[model samples]
Target: MMNLCYNMGADLWNLLRTGGSEMKLLICVLNDTDKLDELMIKLAEAGVKGATIINSTGMGRTLYNHQESALMNSLRALLDPDRDENKTIFTVVDEAQEKAFHKVMNEVVGDLARPDSGIIFTIPVDSVTGLSK
Candidate 1:
């Protein structure tokens, strides 16, 4: 069973590293939940195979809401009072797919430069297991 698990993990790693391109773990902190459906559609259109979406809240949101201290109150002004929670999406993509992801994300979520547009970034992935093609 251990050897079988090892072989399966190796296969998954190879699948992720196909085409000699490095894999990246793309993370997007989407402030607006309204755009989630559209974003998922756009990602699928862009050939993104899979993703994991998590309901999340920023530290500022938590602190501002719970803490009544002077500093927390001051920080509250910096945060958007309207939105309390955020949706964070994670996916793995190759170099080419990363570009496609960026394009589709911008199309659905608007420019990251603008306020409330959300933040997107990527981290290098060394190996992956249990990610099926």
Candidate 2:
């Protein structure tokens, strides 16, 4: 069974609906910057109409930025010199398309089980507005 996370305080009755099915918010974090274009293509082919992508940095990278010390800097560099940036993609998907969405994500992003590949999850959306059909 897929792990479903509920957004607390979202009115159960106010869900976004299209074609008689509720909508879910699909969030994906990808570590590999080079794969973003391919991922977007897959999402479009899977019927995702729109999505938002934001540049993001992990907690370790944030700490590395704030701390200033020769030894610490050297250690951080050795540990993760690149401090690669990540991308967080968000989109609203119909409940009926959940399985297909997962399939496309897995196909483009590869096995999420492998560390640092990225994470894909869904949250039940109570309501949404300004979405174009």
Clashes within 3 Å, all models in order? 0, 0
* For model 2, the run of ten residues with the poorest summed lDDT: 1-10
What is the per-residue lDDT of model 2 for residues 1-133, given as tens digits with 9 covering 90 to 100?
Answer: 1223244324443433355577789888889878889878887888888889999888876785777777876787799755558999898888656777778878887899998888888998767777765
lDDT of 1 by residue, 13-114 (tens): 675557567788999999988889998988898889999999898887787578578776566657855467789999998888899988988888788999
TM-score of 1: 0.74
RMSD of each: 5.6, 7.8
TM-score of each: 0.74, 0.71
Off by over 4 Å in 2: 1-17, 64-83
| Whole-model lDDT values for every prediction | 0.83, 0.77
Off by over 4 Å in 1: 1-17, 67-82
Top-lDDT candidate index: 1
